[model samples]
Target: MADFKSIKVTKGIKTLEIDNPTGYHLIGMGAQGAVFKLSEDRCVKIYTSPLQAKMEREALKAGQHLSFFPRLYEYGDNYNVIDYFNAPTLKEYLRNCTYIPESIAMKLLDILGEMKKAKFTMVDAPLRHIFVLENEELKLIDHVNAFKRIHPVPLKLLRDLNMMLLKESFLSRVKKLEPKTYEMWQAYFNENKMDYRNIPVDPGGDGEGVKVDSAISQTLIGAGHQGAVYRVSENKCVKIYPKTQHCEQEKDVLLSHQDLSFIPKVYETGNNYVVMEYLSGPDLNTFLKKQSALPPVVSKLLLKILTSQKQAGFKQIDAPLRHVFVTNNGFKMVDHVYSYSRIQKRPLELFQNLHERGFLDAFLEQVKVLDPATHAEWTKKPIPLTDEEAQLEIINIEGKTDSKRKKGKDQGKDRDKGRDHKKGHNRDRDRSQKREHGGKRDNGDKKNRNRSKEHGRENDRKKRSDRIK
Candidate 1:
C-alpha cells in the first residue's frame, strides 16, 4: 500500500502546489489539488483542504450510480481513489476541432439531465473538467460544488462555450431539441438584458488600411477633450488629436496589438491623427443606460478584455465606460494612453464607473458566477472612489451654481424692495410739501379778500362824509 500521507500540498495565491515523494505518477493538477494515477484503471485525487476532499467524496459517492461520473473505490481525510480513463479533455478536443458537433451538444445536454436526475444542485462544469471518451460520451470531474451550490443554469458551461466560439451552435441545438430548457436559459439571459444569440464570435475589422487626407472634409462622429473622431470612409475613421504626443502614444499601442481581435485595426498614422477601423455601436455607458441592466455577457467581455490586456503585458488594465464600445462583433476599447504608462493591477476605474451607474452589484454577481477567483481578488481590495468623486464633484459644482443663482435672485428682490420703499418715501414727502404750499397760498388769498372788502367799506364811508360835508 502506498502512503498518501507522505505527499505534501501547499496552497498558493491562486492554486495549490504539490510535493510528491512517493512513486505515484502525477496525472494532473489544479487549484483544488493534484491527481496521481494509482493503477491502469484507478487514480487518486488529493486535496489541499480536507473540507473540499470531503465534499468531493460525498458528491462522488452520491453520483456513482451515473455512468458519466467515475466510480469511487475509497476515500480518506483528503484523498479519493476513483476509476480513471485516459481521455482528452473537452477543452483539448475543441482546440483541435473548428466547431462543436450536434452529437456532442446533445450528449452534454443529456449529462445535465442526468445530473438533474441525481439531484445535483450545480450542474455546471468547465470544459477542461469534462473528459471526452471514445464513444462521444462525456465524463465530469471536480464534483466539489456539485451538491453544495445551487445554480439554476449551467452558467460556467455556457461561459465555456461562449469562449470557445461554440455557444451559438449549441444553443441552436437546444432550441430545436430541448425547447423548454432553451426557453429557460433565454429567459435568464433576457432578465439580465443580454442577447446571447448575437454573442461575438470573431473580432471586428479586416486587416486592411484606410487612406485619409488632412484637408478633406469628413463627417464628425465624436468629439472629446482629447481629440475628435471623424469618419473618413465607410469602414474607417480618423481620430485627430491636438497633441502629437497623445497621438503617438495611442498609435503605438494600437500598432503593437493589431493582432488582438478586440482591438481596432490601425491603418495609418500621422503627426496628430490615426486612421483606424470604424467601430459602429453604442458605447458601454449608453448600452447600459438603454438596457437598464448589466448583462452577464458584458461582464464576461470586460473580464476577457482585462485578461487579454494582462497577457499582452499592459500595465494599465482599466478603461472608462465611455471608452468601451459594444459593437456587433464584440466589445472594443479605445484610448490606450495610460495602458503603458500607468501601473494598475485591476480595473478600478471600470468598477467605479459601474458603481456610479448603479450596476456594480450586478456586475459583481456576474463575476462571482463566471470567474470566482477574479471576484475574490477584486473584492479583496477596495475599489477607488475616483469616478464617484468625479460625479459628486459635478453635483457639487451644479449645487453651488444653483445656490449662487438663488442668492443672486434673492439679492435682486431685496434691491427692488429698497427702490420701491425709497420711491414711496419721496412721493409722500413731495405730497406733504405741496400740501403746505397750497395751504399758504389759500391763507394769503383769504387775507387779500378781507383787505379788499375793508377798503371798499372805507371808500363808501369817505364818499358819504364828503357828500355830507
Candidate 2:
C-alpha cells in the first residue's frame, strides 16, 4: 500500500489525487469523499473532512473482527487502507438481474443478524453500498455510521433498497415472504416520510452548500435571481438560492425538464442550492452586445431553440436573452422559474428591454436575412404574444393619450379667454361712445335754453323798454 502521506488531498472537497495516478483506479465517490483501488488486495477511502475520516476509522476498528465487513489494515487522519474484494456490488447485481429474490432478502436479514451479534449496526444498506462476492457472500462498505444503536426494524435499508431497485421489489419480496416484517418496514416509511438525501438544507444565499473548487484558480461565474453561481469543477457548478423552498422547486423543475437540450443537467441539490453542469460560453445578450450585430447562423439557432421550446409544451418563448447562453451544444437556459413554475409565462419586459437596448431590430434583421422562411411563417402565424407584453404597450399608449388630452384642454382654455377679452373691449368702446353722445345732446339743449332765455330776455327787455317808453 502507498503511504497516505504521499497521496495529495485537495482541500476544497478533500478529493484525493495521487502523485502519479497511473496505477491507481478510481472506484467510487459520495458526498463525503472517494475510494481508489491501489492493487489486487488493497484499496483506500479518503475523506474531505478530518472528522468524517476519524469516525470512519473508529467504526472500522470497532468491527475489525467481523467478517461481514472489510478488513482494515491501517488508517491515517484522512485515509483508510483496507482489503479490496473482487466482487460485484448489489447495484450491479440488480442491474443484471432486474430483481432481488425473496431468498436474497432472507440472506440479507441473516447478514444483519450477524452484525447485530457483533454489536455493529448499519441500517442504511442501499444495494449500492453492499458488495456480493462470487461465493455469494456479502461485504458491506461505508462503516461510518455503524456505531448507531441497531433498530429492531431496518428502516434505512428498506427505503434505500426500494429506491435503488425499482417498484420496491426487494422490500416487496420481503413482504411476501415475511408479511409481519414488511408491515414493520412499511410502517416505518410512513412514520419517517422524509428522505434526508432529497431534503434541502437552507442555502441562505452564497451558493449554499457549495464546496470550494480548490483545484481551480477562480470559480465565480455569475449570479441570477436565485443566487450567486460558482464553478466547482471543470464540469460542475452550483447555484445557491435565496430561500430553501426555491431550491426544492428549482430541483423539481430541473428533473421535469431533463430531456430538454436547452436546460442544464442538475447534479446534486441542497437545501437552498443546486449543483449542475457548468455551461462554457457567454450569454446571448452580452455576445450580441459585443458583436454589435447578429450572424445569420445565430438567428437560425435561436429560432430553432424557440420552436423546440414551443413544441415541448413550454409556451413562454419570450425568454430573456441574458438567461440564454450561446454554446456549441445549443442554447442552454440556466433559469426556468418562468417556464415551469406558477408564473407559467414570460414577462413582456423581456422583449421590451431587447427593443430598448437596440438588439431587437438587429436580431430580427438576422432572422429576416438568414431564415426568411421561418421568419415568414412565424410572422404570418405569429405566436400569440403574452398579455404581459401587451400591458407595457397599453401603458405607453395611455401615457401619450393622457399627454395629448391635457394639451388640448389647455389650448381650449386659452382660446376661450381670448374671445372673452375681445367682447369686453367692444363693450367698453360702446360705453364711451354712448357717454360722449349724451354729453353732446345736453350741450345742444343748454345752447337752446340759453337762446330761448336770451330771446325771453330780449322780449322782456323789449317789453321793459316798451314799458319805459
Candidate 3:
C-alpha cells in the first residue's frame, strides 16, 4: 500500500473508521477490522481491537502449513501485512455464478477432507472466508476461531451453502453428486419438522386458525413459523395461535407489560387470538438492513426498552432485533415469546450477541462519538440510561426522525383516501347497474300490456264480422 503511514483506524460496534490518507481501495470489512487493497499481490488487515489482531497473528502461525490461507509477512499492534490474493469469496462466487458446476462441488468436498487431514477444524472453513480463484483453487482464510475446534462436519459451511442465492440449483447438483451429504443437509434444514423434499412453507393461513379463517375480516400481514399475525383494524391486530396453548404464554407476556408504551398495549384476548395495538413501522431488522450505522436515537430507545423490561419484574430482555420496531410514536418491542415465563435473565444478551457477531464494537464507537466521557466510563462497567437521560441525549436525532414520520403519515393518509375512493366507485357502479336493470323490467311489462290489448281488439272485430255474414 502507498502512503500507508497516514492511515488511522477507529473501531465501532458494527463498523470501523478508516482514515486512509493513501486512498487505498477498501475490499472488505467485519467486526474484526477493514481490509484495504495495497496492490495486486498485497493488502493490509486493520484490526478493530488489539486482541483480534493478536488472535489473527496466532492463527497465521498455526495455519502456516496451509497454502490457501493468507501468508502473514509482518504485523503491527493494529494491522497485519498479508497476501492480498484478490478473488471473490465463495459466498460471492456462488451468488454471481449462473449455475454450480459438478467440478466445483467435488472441489469443495475435497477441501473438507483436506481440512480434516491437516488437523484444521470446520470452523476455519466458512464459505464467506473461502475464495475461489480462476486456476480451480479454493483460498480459505480467517482462522480466528478454527483452531482446535471439534465438529463431525462443517455445519456453518452447510448452513451458508443452504442459504445460497440459487439454493435449489446448488442443492440439485449436490444431490446428484453426493446423495448422502445432500440427505444430511435436508434433515438439518428442516429443523424439527424434517422434510426431504425441502419445499418452502406456505406463507398463508393460521395453522390453528384455518378453521376460523372465514371469520377473519382482515388480510394476513405476517405468518411466522409459530402463528399468523393479522392486522384487523386501524389500531388493532390479532395473533392467531397454533393448536397448542401457545396463545396463553404470549398473552401472559403482553399482560405483564401493560404499563409500558414501548410494548403494544393488549386491547382484547380470546382463547386462540391476541388483539393488540397495531404498531405501523419497519421492524429493527429491516431498518438495520438499510442503514450504514445505528442512529443515536435508536440506540437510546434500545437502552430504555431493556431498562424498562428489567424494572417491570421481567427477568429476560433478550428480545430478537426483528421483534423491535421503529414507529411514529417511538420504538416498541413485540413478540415476547422468550420473556416472563423464564426466571433466568438475559440482561446483556443482545449486546453479547452483537459483540460475538462483530457489531457491538462498531456501535460502541458511535456511542463514544455521541458522548466520549460516558463512553470511556461505560467501557469498564456498562450501564443503561434513564428514559429522560436518553431523551435529552438524542433530542436532535429525535426531531429529525419525527419529521420523517410526519412526511410518511401524509403519504399514508393519501393512500388510505385512494382506497376509500376506489371502494365508493365500486358501490356507485353497482347502484347504476341496479337502476338500469329495473328500467328494462318496467319497459317489458308495458310492451306485454299493449300486445294483450291488440289481441283483444282483433278478437272483437272477428266476432262482429262473423255475425254480419
Candidate 4:
C-alpha cells in the first residue's frame, strides 16, 4: 500500500486540490473526491472530507460480497483502495450498438436485486459509474449513495437508458420477465410524474421522416371517425389518420402545447401518423359512469383544460369528454385535430353530453363555484339539445302517446260489444213469456164452455123425473 502521509490533499472553497508526490496516476474526479490508479488491479479514492470517505467505505463494505461491486481492500481517514475496472462505461458501450439487448436488461435487473439483497436503500446508480467488461459483465464504481439515500426504483438507470433510446426495449423485457417489478416501477414513475417513453426529437435525417417498422406489432386502443390510436409500447402510442393533413394538424397542436402538463408529449410526426405519449386511464366519459356523482375535481379539471386551450391560442376551446383522459396528475386531452381549425368559443359539446346524461346540473354547479365568470358565459344562453337529441325525444313522446290512444280505443270497443249482447238476450226472453201466458188463457175458456153444456143437459133430465113422480 502507498504511504498516505506523503500524499498531500487540500480542500478549496468549492473544490478539492490534490498534490500527489507518490507518483499515482490520476484516473477519475468527482464532486466528492479524486481517484488515482495505484496498480494494475486496484485504485485509491481520496475524499475531500473524511465523512464522505467513511460513508463510501461503509457502503463498499456492505456490498463487498456482491460480484458487481468493486472489492474493498484498505481504508484510511480520507482514502480507500478498491478494485479498478479497466473497461468501458455503459454509456460508451451503447454508442456503437443499435439497440439494448435483453441480456443487458437482465444484468441490470440482477444488479438491482443484488443491491436489494445488500440492504441498500437506494437501488440506483448513474450510467457513468457502471462499467461494461469484455466478457459482458457489469461492475459498479462509485458507492456513495448506494446505502445512504432512498429510491424505490432504479430511476437514474432508466433515465440514462431513455437518453440512449434503449429504455423501451429494456422495459419490454422487464415487463415480460419481472412483471411485478415492472408494475412497481411503473407506479413509482407515475407517482413522481416521470415519463418513461423514449420519445426522439429528431428520428430521421434529410427530411425523410421516421417510418414505423412494418414488423412492429401494435394493439388498437381506440378508434374514431378521424383516426385510430394504437399502443405501440408501454408508454408510447401511435395515432394514424386517413390523410396527412389531419396528422399534421394534431401534431402541430401537440407541439405548441408541449410545455403544458395536460398536453401529451408528441414524439414524431409522419405522413399519416403521429407517435405520442400513451396516457393510461379511463376517458372522462367512462370515468363519469363509474362515479356516483360528478366529482368537483373532475369539473375543475375540465375547466382547466378549456382555460389551457384558450391560453394556448386555440380557437376551439373545447374537447369532447371522450378525448379528455383522467391521469394521476390531472386530465390530459388527446385528438386535437379540430382544436385550432374549428371555431368553438365554449365547451358546448361537452355540456350537451352532460345534459343528456343528467349530469349537466351538477357540473354547472361545480363550475359556478369554481369560475363564476365562465359559468355566466356558459349559462347566458340555455343549452339546447342537439338536433339528434331533439329528434329522439320527439320520437319517444309520440310513441308513448300513440300507444296510449290505441289501448283506449280497443278497451271502448270491448265495452260496447258486451252491452249490445246483454240487451238482445233480455228482449228474446220477454217475447217467449208473453206467448206462454196467452196459450194458458185460451185453454181455460175452452174448458168452461164444455162444462156449461153438460150442466144444461143434467137440469133438463131432473125436471122430467120430478113431473113423472
Candidate 5:
C-alpha cells in the first residue's frame, strides 16, 4: 500500500521559473488544501493529504475522456496542476444573475453524461463544482467521488433515492447537462446490481441529500463570524456557515416564514450552508453611502424589514445591515443564518443600541409600535442612536445586517470600483469609435473650410484695393 501521508514524485514535479513560487492566488479551498491560480489562466491545487493528491491525479487521467473538465497538465504526489479557463464557477456566476441559463445548464448535463458513461458519480455535486466556461460550456471539477460500477451490493434503492434528490435541486442545471444521463446510469447500476458504496454522501439534508459543489464563490459579499454570504442567483444570496450546526439552525427558522418577498427564500441547507435567495442593489451600508442619510421613506422600508424579523421572534441579529438588501421595492431581510436564537434579549439589546446611536429612530418607532409581544422585551432601552451610541456600536455592528459587516474585525474598505469603471470606459470607447467610423466625418471639415475661405477672400480684397490705389 502507498503511504497516504507523503510520496516523492519524480517525473511531473518540475518547478516553473516564476517570479514567486506562484500559485498563491487562492480561487477556492477544501478540507484538504487550497486551490490557487498559477497565473491568469492556470491553477495548481495542493493537497495536504498525499492520498487526495494521488486520487486527484488518477481522476484527472480518467477524466481525460470528458472534455468539460480542466485539462490536467500534470499531477504528482504533493500537487495537481491543470489549465484554468476564464469562466467563473457556477457559485460566482449565480450571484449576479437569476437562474442558470439553459444554454450553460445543458452543457453541464453533457459533462455529467460523460461521467455517467464512465460509470462515475459526483459524491458532492453542489454549485461549487460546476464551472461555466466562456462559451457557455459547463465544466465539472473536484471529482473526489468518482467510482466504477460494483455489482450485487445492498441498499441500492436508498442510494438511488439520494442521487435523485440531488438531481432534483439542481434540476435546472442538470437538465442542461445531458437529459438521459441519470436515467441511463440508473439502468446500468440496476443491470449490474451495483451498490453505490463508493459514492460520497452529502451530510446536508436527509439520507439522499442533493450533491453540492464545495468551492467557495469568488463573489462572496458579506462575511461574518457565523458565516459568509454568496450570490446563488441574481436576486438571492446563499448564506453559508463555517460549520454545519449554524446552517441547520438557520434553515429551521427561515422555513417557518412564508412571506418570500420580505425574506430571501431558503433553497437548501447543509452542515456548512443554507442556500438562500440573493438580491441586487446594495446593502444598507452601501445604500447609506450613496444616498447619505436615509430619507423617511427609505427609513420606513428599513424599519419594515427589521420589524418583520422582530415579529418572527428572532434574537441575536449578528449583522442586520447586511441582511437588509435595498431594492426599488423596499428592503428585504436576506440573511437569517444568525438571527433565530432563543435568547431574545440579545437582538433587542442590539436594536436599542442602534436606536440610541440614531442608526434608526424610524426603526425604533416601528419596533415600539410592535404590539405588546415583541415590544415587551425592549422596555427601558436607554441609549439610542446617539453620537456616543454610534461610536460604541461603530466598533461592532449590532444587528444581523450590520453585524454581517463587522463580525469581529474592523470593517475593511470597500473594494475600489476602478476595474469595473475601466471596463465600462473601454466598452464605451469601442462603441464610440465604431459609430464614428460608420458615420460622416465631413460636418466639421465643411465648417472649417468655410471659415478659411472667408478669411482668404477678405485678404485678397485688401490686396486688390491697395494695388488699385
Candidate 6:
C-alpha cells in the first residue's frame, strides 16, 4: 500500500490524481474517510483509517446491491470518487424537526428493508449521512460502521422496588424539564390518538383517523422518508402524516400566524387530511433547475418567509426548495410535519387539541394585539437579490420554457402553464394528500385526561368540605 499523499497518478487508467494546495480537499470527515468534491458532478472519498482501501472496496461492493447507495465510480490508492450530489443530508433536511411524510417515509423504510435483507446495518443512522438529491432519489454516504451484526443488551431488574424508585425520579424530571411535552404525550395516549406514536407502532397504523392506504399517496414528491406530496388544488395543499400528531400541530401553529407573512392557509382537515391554501409557482429547485445555487432575489424572498414565521413564534421550516413554493407572488412554506419545536414529544398536543375544540378561536377572540414588530429584526439585513441576478433568473426561466417545447402537446402545455395562475397557486397539493391519511389531533383528548387526573384529588377535597357542610 502506498501513502495516499505520496502516490502520484502517473499513467494508470485506474487512478486519476490531482495536485492541490491542501493534501486532500475535504468533503466530510467521518470515522473512516474524508470526502472531497473532485469536480462539479463528481466527488471522491479517501479513507483515513488503517484499511482504507479494503473498507472502500467492501463498502462499494456492498453498496452495489443497494440502489440508494452511491455508485462506485472509481476506487484506487485509498480514494474512491463517485457521483456528486448537490442535495442536502437527511440531518440537514430535518432541522430540529421530527415526523416525515408517510410516502417518503415508506421509501426510507423500503431502503431500510433492502439494507436489512442484504444484511447491512447502519449503526449511527443520524440524519447527516443520508442525502436527498434531485429527481427525488435518496443516496447514502459515510459507511464507516455499516453492515455489522449487533448483540442485544439485556437487563434484569427487581420489579417492585425499582418501579417505586424509578417512577418518582423519571416522572419528577418529566414534570420539571418537559412538562408540556409529557402532557402532550399523555393527552395523546389518554385520548387513544397514538397513531403516529413512533416507528413500528402497528408497523404503520393507529386508527386515530380515516385509515387511508399509506401506499396510494406514497409516490408524491419526496426524497427519502419525508413522505410523498401531491397536488390537490390551485389554492391549497396538505402534508400526509408520516410520523405523528406533531404534523397537524405544526400546520396549526403556522396557520395561527397567517396574518404575519406568506405561510400557507389551513382550510379543512380530517384525522389525516389537512386542506391548506395551495401556493402556486415552481419551487426554487424547478426555477433554478440546472443552476448550482439560488440567485439573490429568490433566496431573499424565501428567507423573508422564514424570518416571518420565526418572528410569529413558530419554529422555522428547514427543508429546501422541495418544501417551498416559489411563485411569481413570492414564496410559501408547504410542509411543517418536521418543523422545529421546543417540546421534545407531543409539542403540538396543547395547541392542536385547543384548535380542534374552538378553544383557540375563543382565546384569540380576546386578543387585539397582532404585532409585526416581532419580525422587525429582519429589516436590518440587506435584500438577497440584485438587479443582475433577477434579470438572469428571468432569462433562465425563458430558456427553460424553450427547452421544454420539444416534449409536445399536453406535456408542453403543462410545462408552459406550470406557472399559470391556478396551477401556479396549487404548488403544494401533494403535501395535503399526505396529511389526509393521518388522523387529526383532538383537543378533547387533553381535556379528558386533565379531567381524569383531577377527579380523585378533587373528590378528596370535596369530601373534606362535606365534613364542614
- lDDT (Cα atoms) of all candidates against the true structure: 0.64, 0.54, 0.55, 0.63, 0.45, 0.42
lDDT of 2 at 429: 12
Candidate 1 local lDDT, 1-469, one digit each (tens): 5586677776753235567667766666665777777777887888889999999998998998888898899888988888776777786678656667888888999989889988999877767678888887788888988887776677767655654457677899898889999998889766654222211122111211122222222333443334555545557766766656667877888999998777888888877778888776666766787667887888989988988998998876765676777777788877675477545667766876686577877887898898898877766644444423222212121234212444333222211111111111111111111110001121123236657855654564355335434
Candidate 2 deviant stretches above 4 angstroms = 1-4, 13-23, 96-98, 148-156, 164-167, 176-180, 193-201, 208-305, 308-335, 338-469
Best-fitting candidate, scored by TM-score: 2
Model 5 Cα shift for residue 285 (angstroms): 7.2
Worst 10 contiguous positions by lDDT, candidate 3: 417-426
Per-model TM-score on C-alpha atoms: 0.45, 0.47, 0.41, 0.42, 0.42, 0.30
Query: RMSD, model 3, all Cα superposed?
Result: 29.5
lDDT of candidate 2 over 185-298, digit per residue (tens): 668657755432333223222212222221121223443334445445556667665556556766876877789887788888877677888776666665677666556666
Q: Who is ahead in TM-score, 1 or 3? A: 1
Name the regions of candidate 4 deviating beyond 4 angstroms.
Answer: 1-5, 11-14, 194-469
Worst 10 residues of 2 by lDDT: 420-429
Displacement of the residue 366 alpha carbon in candidate 2, Å:
18
lDDT minimum window of 10 residues, candidate 1: 417-426
Residues 1-469, candidate 6: write the lDDT tens digits: 2234442222112122323234333344343444555556776665544465566567668878788877777777667767777777654454433334444444554565576566665422333456777655777765544644331100011111111123233334444555664475356436542222121211122212222332221112221222323334334445455544644665676656667556667776555445566565566445555454334455346446654655565543232444456655567655454344321111122222223332322322222123234223322222112122112211121234222334232222211111211223333222222111011222123335656755643554345335424
Where does model 3 exceed 4 Å of error? 1-6, 96-99, 148-151, 165-469
Model 5 stretches astray by more than 4 angstroms: 1-23, 90-106, 123-128, 132-138, 148-300, 303-319, 325-329, 332-469
Instruction: Assess the local accuracy of residue 158 in candidate 2 as a C-alpha lDDT between 0 and 100.
Output: 51
Q: How displaced is residue 264 in candidate 1, in Å?
A: 4.8
* Ordered list by lDDT, greatest first: 1, 4, 3, 2, 5, 6
Please give the RMSD to the true structure for each candidate, in Å: 38.1, 37.7, 29.5, 41.7, 20.0, 26.1
The 10-residue segment with the lowest total lDDT in model 6: 151-160
